[model samples]
Target: MGGDHGLAVTIPAAVNLLRTHSHVFVHLVGQQVAIEQSLSRYRNLDPTRFAVVHANDVVTMDDPPAQALRGKKDSSMRVAINLVKEGVAQACVSAGNTGALMAIARFVLKTLPGIDRPAIATAMPTMHHGMSTVLDLGANVDCTAEHLLQFASMGSALVSALQGKMNPAVGLLNIGEEIIKGNDTVKQAAELLRQSNLNFYGNVEGNDIYKGTVDVVVCDGFVGNIALKASEGVAQLMSGTIRDEFQRSWFSRLCAVLAYPILRRVKRRLDHRRYNGASLLGLRGVVIKSHGSADAFAFECALVRAHDAVQNGLLEKITQAMVPLSAEADAA
Candidate 1:
């Protein structure tokens, strides 16, 4: 009961997921009556596969993170996270307020040992028809060199687990691919990454992200957030411009008709819905944040992400990967 459409979006997504994944169980954490009413719309849904865990309050999109954390303990977001903490749920996925979700998740589940801050990481479609995992996507606006290093470690582990890349290449996002191009902080982080056990691929420029130059791209939240939004804007612009051009005149319309098949394939490849879930890495429990504006298909993709992370033991992989970082810290 937290996103733009609340139960209207989530209930349908849950139904769709259950239809495809026979073994998955769902906990609908919201008002019981409303949840039941929504679930009643669909036909032939298995009752045993999903259950409603009622939550009294809701964290609105405008709610402050502190208020969501302290004032609304019974909000759907908080209660869902609590289920994860209590071992009743393996993971928690929310399309709620991003700030509130992060604050509540960090407070309730706590960060993993050796993690100073939890970073938001997500997979983006690359030019090579592959995916690149980028981290610190609006989680930490200001970061130390050590924090960037931590993001690299967690991101490598995330790709290794989800993408089946045993040793994912890691790159530090910078102004240029040259090592001497960034500020002191980035230079320091580069040195740290080079010294670490990760398979660091050195500095990468913004365009290299789309080129699939590395499996993991680590950057501070400010740069990462900007990059994400810019890429999204470009995708929308390209699709929209193509549609408008096709509708401008009869000749263009005829051309569009002839190119319809190719255009359809392009639209499918660039669909943002396919990449809706963003994992909150460095948390002890698996927590995924979905875009609040997501529709049913996009939300289902987020659910699939949660399932994939659980199946791959994301938490355990990150813990094991961090051991080397911890050892280095102890040695220092």
Candidate 2:
């Protein structure tokens, strides 16, 4: 987990979560000082569940991930991934530098058969209909048409597994919903998707994301990141506005007390912590990314996600499915 504020909270949760698993040794890889401090603080934690393997150096959020991975030999990110590569750990989770996380995962785990670059993918609630997943959120701001196509393919497969939907509707994020809209990449991506073997539901506008128009929405990181942040902003702003309105009048204040249970429920629904982690799809191994600002409960949420991915063999399934799809790449 990211060693930010709330690490105290995350540590206990991690201890309890791992206590039930057998031989779950943790390699607490990060900048040397942080890892030691963290281990020392949690000395009384479950001895049977996690043994500490320390990493001294970690890339910070400010550093460029690709460059840092090459420059630092014992980076915490690399060390964690190397442990996984060497069979030391089944999986790893981090709330630290996301760029380094992606770079190291690629360098260590490499990509699966059909994967060019592993993309960060997450499921989010939508306005139009049911919840949907979005991919390449910040993995690649400038992407090729092929990249968008790959995201759609992988995103759909993941949603099918998690949501238990067969041939889930897939949509391309576009400015306009018409078949001939969007920039060159979006237009070309639409054309390619329609020809591909995966389910394609044509183009969808940003306004339509919550309408449940598609099971998975595909876009470059730039657009996807904007869409994600915008959604989060809107949810927060709406909640704040409602809270202020309730506090303004005596009757409304009384009503708020009456609606306290309902308000709490709404807050819980919008809690990003519950949806704190996302999968880095198309890697040889499974890598789960947690929010950088994640507290201990947030980290705990991420650890649970990693455990699930490990148990379910998410990497194995993606590899099996991707092998057949990206056969030409392997052949080449």
Candidate 3:
């Protein structure tokens, strides 16, 4: 109900997931009539695996985060999250206002023990033919050294659970590989990460992200958000330029035909839709934030992510990793 196309994208994605995963159950939270109408379009849908919960209000993209939190108590976003809180659902996925989703999630699910704020963790495509998990992607603009350390722990645990990378290498995002490059907070965070039991790979420069020098990269929200948007812009620019050049002339069009298969592979490799669903880590419950403008395929990727996280016991893994940190905090 909150996304650009609302149920048009979500319902189809839900149907796809239900068809594919027999064990998965999806609770559609929105206006009953709209949901029913959407589901009616699909004749082969399994009605037993899907249920719709009515939500009277909707939190729009333009709505302020605080306003959405204070009001809109019956919004679909809120109801979906409540399902997670009530153990009726293992996770909640939404393509809605990021700020409102984060605010409401923090208020409802609360933060995990030893985590001051929840950081957004998402996989970024890398040149190494793999993905790097980067955290604090626009979740907390400012962060303390402790927060950065927490991000590293959460990210490491996430990669381990999702990617099956036990003790995955962790890197602190910095201006330089040298220890003296970044601000005091990052430098201090580096020290903490080094001392911890994680597989710290020292400071990693911006270029190292694409190099896949580490499995996990940790940064404050301000820097992580900038990096994410910049990389996305570059990908778009490159794709557009290639397309324009290919259409410039008859010869180029012929060349494009010859290179069609390779270009398709390249496009698939860099497709951001494949990497949709940013996890709001450090929360008590699983909440995935899909891009607000995501289409049906992209939204389906988000649902897959949420399902994978639940099946892999992401919450339990993060909780186990936080126990040592929580004890240390108490000792201090």
User: Backbone clashes per model, in order?
Assistant: 0, 10, 0
Can you write out model 2's per-residue Cα lDDT over 1-332, one digit (the tens) per residue?
34464345555656656665555566555544554565576555655555556665657777788776888767667877888888788877877778888888988888887778788988776653267788889988899888888888788777766666778788999988898788998999898788777789988888766777788889999888888999889888998899899999999999999999998987776577877778888887768888887876667777777777777667766665565457644565
Model 3 regions lying over 4 Å from their true place: none
Residue-level lDDT of model 3, residues 46-93, one tens digit each, is 778989999998999999999999999999999999999999999999
TM-score: model 1 vs. ground truth: 0.98
TM-scores for all candidates: the values are 0.98, 0.87, 0.98
What pairs collide in candidate 3?
A: none
Model 1 residue runs over 4 Å out of place are: none
Better of 1 and 3 by lDDT: 1
- How do the residues 109-203 of candidate 1 rate in per-residue lDDT, one tens digit apiece? 99999999999999888885798999999999999999999999999999988888989999999998888999988999999999999999999
Please give the CA lDDT of all the candidate structures.
0.93, 0.76, 0.92
Worst 10 residues of 2 by lDDT: 1-10
